[model samples]
Target: MPREGLEVENLHLWRGEHHVLRGVGFALPRGGCLHVTGPNGAGKTSLLRAACGLLYPESGRLLWDGRDVHEDLPTFHSVLMYIGHEAPLKADLSARENLRYWIGTRRRIGRDTLGAALQRVGATAWSERPARTLSAGQRRRVALAALSLLLVPLWLLDEPTTNLDAEGQQLVGTLIEEHLARGGLVLAATHHELPLPRSRVQRLELTHE
Candidate 1:
């Protein structure tokens, strides 16, 4: 077996003294993908949050490339991108402006790549429209476009296909495939089935007792 790209050992999490996750553990190799599926309140979001260092685990370990992710958050974050259920775009800014601002804030990509990213997401039509004026699907595209400009290896997405139309869904599916082909890893939590290779994916379910 190859070394795991991401791992969680005996992970446990809680919310206000209520246990949410119970000793959940799994490992994915480099270039692997995992789809976490479960009913609402099954700790799916909590698990992703904990793994990405956004939430602290009550007990357990999260390792990236065999090293403790919490030990050096900066380095770990550099290799990872976490997109949560809520869109992180600024509603006041235009689609293009949002991407431009994020890129400038992170300085992750060059100025020249901005237009290309917007074009990739099919946001060229309304790139100049304020995010508030755009539909939910359009906003999500902007967020995805931001991710494309970065060079991260691990992508943790939550309901990434939500609010997307058929074409948008296919677009996202293609993006994931491309990511995996590049030896990158993806751990996504979705409520709907995604059109992707099931052989290279594993399903994990979280439920309450």
Candidate 2:
């Protein structure tokens, strides 16, 4: 497997007429996790989106394996998994159904693997429940379960623990740890403290321009 490494150089973005990210740069190697922190109106979210090719930078560039991500978007996206604040689930679909839908888009997964994923995220009990009927935390778990179903090397997460309680928060930490242990890279924007060990984690703080 290729070692996933991400580099952002002098990134600058504008949201409307206001500048969001200003000369932002960072590098994350395989098995590393970067925690992005800042107050509201700061450019943390913008930075994550730019890094994942969701938003284009006005200047500078994002590189995966030292090549511009925009140069080959499909290859970059194939190894990247991004989960923002909203749970990207269909209201009418059951949690299992949603997972199956997303998994199908990437690769085939067996019933056992799906079950294990749900179990790992503590969403097994409500796996058959419609997403709309689940609580915020439950829905978030359903989204997190998708992580277990796939092995993407880079994860760009925005407020991953948004609606979770203590246990759910712990689950997120465990998942990050497991991913890092397997040499996956993570860049997360969060207001809350994540439970990752400092050795494998780095911090990046953003300020509003």
Q: Which candidate number would show the highest lDDT if scored against the true structure?
A: 2
Cα lDDT of model 1 by residue, 128-167, tens digit:
9888899989988987897788768899999999999998
TM-score versus the correct structure, for each prediction: 0.95, 0.96
Error of 1 at 179 (Å): 0.5
- Cα displacement (Å) at residue 137, model 2: 0.4
Ten-residue segment with the worst summed lDDT in candidate 1?
103-112
lDDT of 1 at 3: 59
Across residues 1-209, which tens digit of lDDT does each residue of candidate 2 receive? 43349988899899999999889999899888999999987988888888889898899978898888899999999999998888799999999999999878998998999999999888878899888899988988987898767899999999999989998988889999989999899999987888776776799999875
Best by TM-score: 2
